[model samples]
Target chain A: MNPILKRLGFRPDDRVVIIHADDLGMCQATIPAVAELFDAGLVSSAATMVPCAWFPAVAAYARATPSADIGVHATLTSEWDAYRWGPLSTRDPASGLLDDEGYFHRTTPAVQERARPDAVAAELHDQINRALAHGIDVTHLDSHMGSAFAPHFLPAYLAAAAHARVPPLVPRLSEERMRAVGMPEEMIAFARNIVPQLEAQGVVMVDHLIGMPLDRHEDRVETAKQLLGSLAPGLTYVIIHPAIDTPELRAIAGDWRARVADYQAFCSAELRAWVQDQGIHVIGWRPIRDVLRGA
Target chain B: MNPILKRLGFRPDDRVVIIHADDLGMCQATIPAVAELFDAGLVSSAATMVPCAWFPAVAAYARATPSADIGVHATLTSEWDAYRWGPLSTRDPASGLLDDEGYFHRTTPAVQERARPDAVAAELHDQINRALAHGIDVTHLDSHMGSAFAPHFLPAYLAAAAHARVPPLVPRLSEERMRAVGMPEEMIAFARNIVPQLEAQGVVMVDHLIGMPLDRHEDRVETAKQLLGSLAPGLTYVIIHPAIDTPELRAIAGDWRARVADYQAFCSAELRAWVQDQGIHVIGWRPIRDVLRGA
Candidate 1:
């Protein structure tokens, strides 16, 4: 059992989970879907992509809803074919954060191969600072596409979270699990060495990080149930990408169906009732943030 | 006599000029300068670049102050080396709006050579519609870098403005003046043919368009006075790009000094008195927009 769960007032045997939605400001389709989930109390946490075109809408929502548990979805890659964004801190090609086309590289491997660690750090800080300036009471930090989890970049990611005084989504995983997620051996070694030190410094670490495959378009509700049923004791972070079904979304995203399904699955009354019936404890990042801040 | 002055309730001899600022949403430096100029009743009109990162800030200002004479600066080029943006309508490589770097081409000639007329039209409409959706009472349409003035794209520009029922910036210039501004011979001929047709439809056209050389970082106040003094006895559009002096501005714009100078020049009490002493009548785009909308 992770001692940080105990610090968060959870028992060793308790199965606490945070239902977090990623990519809140990716486009028009995302904002309404996440807002609905937050309004219905279906989602406990969400992070905004600060570099995306629709970010100001998310900033407006955060200002309007001061209690919303929103954080910076620290971005290092612009993955879409048509929709793309570059780094906020620096546009110099020497920063190695941009692809040949000047947008952030589309893949994590490309980022790992090219992005300078100092530039990564600067961008992470810039993203978080921009969110703060927009009046977001940033609750935590997380990665988009796990770009920050690259071996060369992870230190900067942790440093940014530390600097922001917020928890980062650093889930505890075995070397095999890390390798299964396509994390390089160097990153696996780095995470193993550093995560424990972070925990020792009273940083809250999740015991598990569960998420549906982004490309899988099958029934998400059933998948959610299966994942929730398999949750072990300690804190778990359940990541989702939920967006409203719209023609604009269809144009912007290749996995539009999966995103729409995630929204429906999470917002469903059946799923809400099932989580309660299963005696699972659902928590948001706010309380954890408070604990970390020693409030 | 250009009949637009009469339709706009100005006499044929009225020295009416719109003291207009371009690139209001290009960066943070622009917003405050334009807002102050508008507040001080110095500058008469301004337009925003919808694709710029700071566009939402401009939208927020427009929403808060509904009477600001803001228009869409129809953008087809992202000229900055580090700071760049792409089209909103579509990001398909085939759209020809984007250069090899996936941003709008860095030069007007590149846009003229590669951009499809259909793509240019779609993007123009998208920029306008986006500003409208954000609560901007869009007052007029103008081109960025004169990209729309290309002979092939001029028709699309006119069509977009006609569809939106807003006046577009069509300045009546002689072949000599057009050639002096580096207008292609084809564009010069095209404008000569189309200006009369547009004027017949009651679209307000400026008798003269005056702007300082973008590369010239001289005493802008003296230049402004000279230009105002030389205004022909008809409606003139005096275009300026004003921005507050900031280190960020210094980074984003090569002509930061000139931009700051423009802001200072327009906001100066001396310049205001000089314009008044010369009997220059300052107006904004709102009245023209109202006339076009038949309000």
Candidate 2:
């Protein structure tokens, strides 16, 4: 464990922030931008969508950079109208995962109503196997959308992650597990119960992580920088979607411009300086892997 | 589905490269690199490590970017010598998951012998629930270190993914699934068998993907550029990892620098120019999602 992280203090001055990139293979516009930032030492890490068509390209990169922190984006619910994917398992037609066009249904509810854990895990394994075959060295696992975390799907998600042996994005906790099963609880108590369960699960926990709203470009950047500046040293992961504004992306995604703006702000020299000024320690999975190995 | 994507074939050009950045919370070095890469629009997507201590930082970013394509890096064995994590489910002292230090043993073999799918699924669900509570918009699910893909854990991985309703990267065909079952074959045969299963499952399929050794960064980038220049283009997911270099990373990992180098080449103006020059459309999940919905 990081010495500083091992003894996390409450002071904002002793904080370490992990600036993460989301959607490496979701589109072409996003890839290059992600690359430039990492090359320039502006960002720390990024993950991929194994189900999308662009994964081969992503895998090649991961293979070449055996050490770059990488992970599987547990996917479900193809949300785009024009673009979508289905489960990797074909044994269950009753899952209702596919649409009339033979593509994955676009909504989480559709999946929730139809899919089963058996089929979902088969497909999830397929994606990871694909990455492995491609020589993509995956470092961890995460959800593509919140679909895995939904009340109905939580149990299935955990089974898959555990089977995979890769650290998941969220800590597994009994109470949280209960909540996912649709149990109602007092927010404070629920949150309180969550910590112990998480600890027991060997999950890496944190006090907070900040989110960025697409429309709020300026606020996104400001909040990100502020969050980075104000972080405590235990371990924090901050996510971002950086894409270049292009005609194709614009036509398909209305928020491409905002993503680009956020990207621009994040890669700016100012933010880098802020991180430095804040005395924040920027690190990656290699160390964590090392620490974990040593532990 | 960009009309252009439809117009193109999937053999070479038709692929959507889904390059995923894995291990978001593995260490401080990885997180920022991923975030910057996202900001730079380098890759299409990324995922998070739920078990690592730095997860909150990563998940917060996922929450902020509702549409930013992301996923869960399902975890199990902590495969490092020093840094280690164990099953969220409690283990008996005799389970042997613990290293000398009492954390979960760090390799797949160790965990494989001792882990039960039920316990695995429970942990996977807990991780997903945690991400949901933290607010992550995940796109898919996948494994870490191919642990779940191993024959011993295949069923567990499939069950979990199916239950979660997320698309697993692996295809559910005989030949393809056989790979997970340890029946390896030529790449061509593997690809051939995979297509049918993916189609039958209503799961999206990739034309092809490949991985290379880290030291062969030049070959990897050059090959990718060549591949992209001649890409078939229906929709392919290319996966990769982007990270900034640091001493901590160097000590924790071996061969990862090549990944950093590949990331550099990926974001190069020359590469971006090559992509544009070839008229290959790079996209995020929005278009892919839209197309899948339409499909």
Return the TM-score for each candidate structure.
Answer: 0.57, 0.46
Q: List the residue pairs that clash in candidate 1.
A: none
Winning candidate number (DockQ): 1
Off by over 4 Å in 2: A1-4, A7-13, A99-101, A171-195, A218-223, A230-233, B1-295
lDDT per residue (tens digit) for residues A151-183 in model 2: 456556656655655555663234655476554
Estimate every model's Cα lDDT from 0 to 1: 0.84, 0.59
lDDT of 2 by residue, B140-185 (tens): 6666765665554555665665565555555333455447645446
Summarize candidate 1's per-residue lDDT along B100-216 as a digit string, tens digits: 645689999999999999989888887888788878898899999888988789888988888888889988898999899787787788888888887787767788899865787
Query: Where does candidate 1 stray beyond 4 Å?
Result: B1-170, B173-295
TM-score of 2: 0.46
Q: Cα deviation of A97 in candidate 1 (Å)?
A: 0.9
Model 2 lDDT vs. the true structure?
0.59
lDDT of 2 at A60: 67
Worst 10 residues of 1 chain A by lDDT: A81-90
